[model samples]
Target chain A: MKQKVYLYRAFERFWHWSQALIIFFLALSGFEIHGSFSFLGYQSAVKYHNMAAYALVILIIFAIFWHLATGEWKQYVPTAKNIKAQINYYLLGIFKNAPHPTRKTVLSKLNPLQRLVYLGFKILIIPTMVLSGLLYMFYRYPQNGSIEGLNIESIKTIALFHTAGAFILVAFVIVHLYLITTGTTITSNLKAMVTGYEELEDTTKSQLESKNEVISAEVNNE
Target chain B: MKKIVISLVLIGLIIISIISFVSPKETKQSKLNELKAELSKKTTPSVDHSKFPILQKKIGSPQEVTEACISCHNGRAQEVMQSNHWNWEREEFIKGRGVVYLGKKNAINNFCIGVEGNELSCAKCHIGLGMTSSSTYSYTDSKNIDCLVCHDNTETYAKAPEKGGAPDQTLDFSFIAQHVGKPKRSNCGVCHFLGGGGNNVKHGDLETALFEPSKETDIHMASSGMNLGCTECHKTEKHLISGKMYSLSSMNRNRATCEECHTDNPHSETVLNQHTYKVACQTCHIPVYAKVNATKLDWDWSTAGKLKDGQPYEEDDKDGNHTYLSIKGNFKWGKNLKPDYIWFNGTASHYLLGDKVNDTTKALVINPLNGSYNDRNSKIIPVKIHRAKQPFDPVNRILIQPKLYAEKPGEGALWKDFNWQRASEVGMKEVNLPFSGKVSFIRTEMYWPINHMVSSKEKTVQCNECHSRDNSRLAGLKDFYMPARDFSPVIETAGTGIIFFAFAGVLIHGVIRIISTRKRKMKV
Candidate 1:
């Protein structure tokens, strides 16, 4: 038997979709600004990129607060449990229609490999992009009838790091689009994110129900 | 129902971000004023010339004013007499020619030719009185010296053109003599700003707008900042000015430089400081020149005699630049111009009067800056290039100084007779040079160093302006390779080849995996 369970919250779905839209716009406009393409024109691309970047910053701030308040940040923590099994499942077992190594629950949504990749983006790549972009924006400021801000020697390094981060995001998005189709069905993960509900196997459902009942019973006795 | 509220919040955040980006930019005038007050800490003059009793006497001529000035300040005229301002001559030791004499009076330029045949109009800029090409003015005489030209604090005193360096007779001499103080901007700019016959005609850097310039026009000489005067940098000792004109002298001992104040390492960044050794300070600092007025860049004497019904015809271009003039020539003027970049040390090689030049096909370099990229002491500098097609002596292979104007109508001037031979003959006779009598027009080029009208640092050149893919400013300049703009063909091919192989490998591996998975499912 299988049962439907609540997986994603309303704000979680909102933040995820909004952040994805912003990143997509930023990447397209950013590449145009780097002289990769010329569909939007250089000046317009720069303006759009700046606007999307600001919106992304706001979304990130809201998402960070929500994660901390709801204790959902724990889902991104890397663990050794079933790590090798998850890697092997994606590499070879997925093509043979084998079972997944780890099961998803409301409290723990991501597998070990997914946790490590998301954590890398959150801790390293995002910060690098934000820092370099801000440096480029405020490089020159009018002070005392003269421009005297940002005593940096050159903008070459900042440009290089920003470009590298953009390429990494491009690769990550391509792989992510393919992985979302590898659920119970091709549309399973997408439907769960949209409707805040997912179908869980009978064994996994019984295990979660027993864990909740024991915690509630303990709280009642205390 | 909860998703609707989340969507509204996201929309609200985007609206706020856009509003912040489009907010109005505020001007910081008060901050500039505070900075100006802080930088203006120089000491005032100690002596006041208004208390002198000899200046109270009546004066008719400029000599009378000079006599009254030297009555109080003894030996001042002797000091002024030793300066080039009084002699109008400079003697330099050239490599091929020993001890060559060169100065404004001795050199032949493209504009207005030289001071010969029409010295009265030219003497308006001269320091002494009653100077003519024929008459020998006494330089040692104290009465011949004009003190009011440099010491006039009153803006009223001015030397009228064709009056032979004499102040206008209408002004009160006693009041001007009493109000005498240190030279102001207007005093020095009276001649310097109006050189080469009119305002902003000769030098692309110096102009009348520099009288009280804004910070954007000139950071150092801005009225809102340090507010420097002409004498501040071109410091004078014993009445001898320190500045040297590149057209007049190639090298000099008294040349003032920006390193005198800003030092070698002015920028905080080590990379920018390293650039100072290879590039000139003005190359990056003074990005453009001639901001206030359009400067004349080219003149074609071949098109000079265009007439409309026996009257001189004149026409202006779409930009209001004088394109054709019967009195002068066809002129091309440019405003806010980008300078041509070149390598220059502290010296230049000049084509002096009567110097034999070859290569009539290309433009003759009247005076070329002496330096190259391979030289250690040379730095990349910006210069205003002035090109012209002027009359030259083909037989002698020398540039001719044609008398362009006359005080009276019958002086055999080029404008009067429309004859280059008569003007060249008269000019050569007056200057004591051999006349070939055979005249021809040749293309000539001159370089003027751009050092004034410096903008703030942020408005300077960007990297892509010089290091771009096509039509870059540094396109013809070899010796360095620019990244992002140029790539090595060998390295590029190797990198692309590796990427192609990696992509093919991934495609084959994924296809094999899919086929094997389908075959196993079919067997089961």
Candidate 2:
């Protein structure tokens, strides 16, 4: 059993859960706007999307401020410790109940591989969407003389970027949703997010002892 | 992280502001208006603008003077005002205020003395306002201008010029309608150039052959009085002025030129195949005199006192029985790549008032005319005997690309093999139009409806896997089927499947640990 302290603050939990909700709705409405579904028809989907975008921006601002004030931003600082080990365990070892190579602590809520994944989402996907969406929304009514440097007669490039970014964002959401279900207890991690508390072992010392004995007996039988 | 986010936001606002303020289009519209106002002020005269007296009854056409003669000579007062003929008519001034040549008639007025005087010649023509003959020309102030030239021909001042006279050196057909057909008649070449001989009429379609667009164009010099422009009626003929007579149609009045009234272009609006908008008429019609007569146009305006049209200054030359132009050329549209501006040349004379005479105050409409020129670059030269008699410009431009629409896809749908064709007509007999053809991609390829942009929220078109790709664990487009391209499958069988099973194992481990933790907490 591994032990872990109360690392995630109330604000952190709030930011995480709220961000997830916003992104989920954003993906839904965005696809709706892209003519993917009819849950909210084209017009309503666009309305909801625009509203969700505004709300996401507001939530991000608060989260940023909270992260800055609390110095809790260090949790997502990506490092390469046990990175290969983590990959291998996910690829093969986990089927035999192989233990995680990295442990969680109050100072570091995410493991080495988790840090890399979080960094990619923050650096690549989100910023791409923000820039592309803003360009698309306000690029209108351009007269020939107004922007001499720009070819206002054509908007193919901007549209292409906006559409491409949308596909990437959707792709990321699909993967994220799948991985969420793969958490510690199909419903347990989900419950923890809802209740803001996760029960766990105090240390991996007992877990390692039991596993070692089981391993030795299996080897002998083989 | 907090500082980084804030900075990014502020940077975006700054960038947007810079883009908004740097546009240049606002300056051009104002400049065009200013140029128009300046040109109008400089070129159009303010004198002789008097109120015309209204008469009660309409006068009947003279039985002796034919309708052909009536149209050719009608509005001579107005036409002369627009030509160089007015220059010769001006009363010579020895000094400042007093008018000389007051009672003296110039020998250039040949039309009144010629043999065709009553037979389609200027001598037999009705002199409208300023001349001395027409013994019954009861009007006074002989130099002012007469409306009776065409309106009241019986006044007697009109007549055709005689043989061996200076080319009736009088202004004729100075202004013409645009649509007049081929063998151009009076519309295009008459005032466009001063060709042909003294008493011999020039250009084929006589002045009476002109008609409006709404009317059918008469082909031969003898008109059927159809609605067609001078270009349509005259075609290639350089002379002839006797034919059927029709009342002139009123101008559209929305604008004086084709451009102002035709901002929405017909050629591009229909876009039958594919093409960009056509250029405005004036853009390529800039004035060049060589383009008028001789060719291989050259210029030395860089030097002073340079003679334009260097091939023997033809005017007032002793040996000039008129050199036969070796190169015969036809009139056609000139090609112009630049689609924006038109530079034109013209002059306005201050003197030559028609007739300061009897009840001539009927007001003429002051139409703001835009100078028109056919682009000659696209037209092939017509084979003809004389230099000026050949066709000079072409009317239609068909060398442009067509359009392809995504949604409506009337003609555009044909390219992508879209079958929006009328489904009911497949079994019908005698369907002249085939709803399908190679343009519809009927054969050669079977990938129909491949590039359709039906990204609309139709469940029939939307793929669930496409929308949900990002929601799960696929890093990129790791495994998905696209209908547009050839695809063998995303995940190969055997080894890859084994790896997927391993991923499933990790998920199961996580789930069991989470379950065990919850149970232990419950016991405690």
Please report the candidate that would top lDDT against the real structure. 1
Q: What's the TM-score of each model vs. the native?
A: 0.65, 0.34
- lDDT per residue for candidate 2 within B113-207, as digits (tens), equals 11111112221222332232222233332233323232221222222343111122232311111111123233232332232231111222222
Model 2 misses residue B99 by how many Å? 37
The CA lDDT at B159 in model 1 is 82
Candidate 2 chain B has its poorest 10 consecutive residues by lDDT at B441-450
In model 2, how large is the Cα lDDT of residue B493?
35
Predicted structure with the largest DockQ when compared to the true one: 1
Docking quality (DockQ) for each candidate: 0.09, 0.08
Weakest lDDT window of 10 consecutive positions for candidate 1 chain A:
A139-148
